[model samples]
Target: MERKSSSSMRLPPAVQAAALAAVGGSRLQKEFAWMSWAGTVWRLEGQSGAVYVKRAGDLKDERDRTVWLAGRLPVPEVLGLFGGFGDDWLLTRAARGVPLSDPSLGWEPSRVARRLGEILRDIHALDAAGCPFGERKLGHVLIHGDYCLPNVLVVDGRLSALIDLGLAGLGDPQDDLAAGVWTLQYNFGPGHAREFLDA
Candidate 1:
């Protein structure tokens, strides 16, 4: 299938309005990457701090989940939420530091893999009862749902926050671990599968 660049896509009117309001005087920059789901993200920076605006099809509600998880997890702060016109828009304060995708980090696969493991372990250890959205009997704690290198932020060798919480909720730990490994392989190399698993 052909992939469409985010630069070519436009946000719905309602979503655009919400993003503009959240950004205020911030400068908005379009992030040219396709979401696993039909969505696009824009980065806004200003005196307050950086913020990210995302627009997704209204198939599910990620805004509420992100807001509910704010004090409980290392995730973005929901600056605004808007729904209408068949799209859901979420504006969040940017996670401090760079995503694992930052080449300036110059981290080897092992280091990234180890960090991924550590962060995932911490996430799985959180008290699921504290999650307001509720959970399943999956025998594990909350999951990032979309645990991947790009979705994770690291600052000075420590996990700063998690992004793309649209898919997050309670589930088996293995699911997140598997997805993490898959993303590691995709971003690094096939060998990264073993390296991440070993990490």
Candidate 2:
């Protein structure tokens, strides 16, 4: 299904202040999360560093999962979290490199497929014992439940970071595997999907 763009939705005033505070009152804020349905992301270039501020409604499980996985995974560091009127904003350091969805990167389909495969394999191989939400006895590892192409960032042709962790929890590993394959096919076509499965 086609998703609607949030290009027209300007960040609410409260959210903007929160973002500015996150970076010590920096004024450089750019809207960047165009395709996201869960929330709006702002790229804030502060005096100290760059951070991506995510504003969402009823965060539910996303906040906890992010905090839990911060030191254990290659995710962005959560600098702060604020809640107001049933909405929440998450401030995190900017992820390194470009997202796999960036067409300008000109990555070959097969190469992207291979990298995604390796990422999934590595994630599934992590020790579930340390995962607060994983049910290890059920053969579930800490899977990126939304392991789609856009959620993965590639740096120098390798998986650098994984974003969007609201759905991450104990579940069948195949869910992540299938989502990865589906994303490959959706983004690069059938040949790429086949290559990913084969790899």
Q: Model 1: runs farther than 4 Å from truth?
A: 1-35, 130-135
TM-score of each: 0.81, 0.84
Worst 10 residues of 2 by lDDT: 1-10
Most lDDT-accurate candidate: 2
Clashes of each: 0, 0
The collision pairs in model 2 are none
Per-residue alpha-carbon lDDT of candidate 1 for residues 82-141, written as tens digits (9 for 90 to 100)? 676777767777778778867789999878888888888888888778565545774857
* lDDT at position 178, candidate 2: 90
RMSD of 1: 3.3
lDDT score at residue 140, model 2, on the 0-100 scale = 70
Please write out the lDDT profile of model 2 over residues 1-199, one tens digit for every residue: 2343334446556656755666665575464654467786767665556777777786647777888877767887776677767787777778897877778789788888888888788887776566777565667777989998888888887777888898886779889989988898898778777666666
Task: Give the Cα lDDT of each candidate.
Answer: 0.72, 0.75
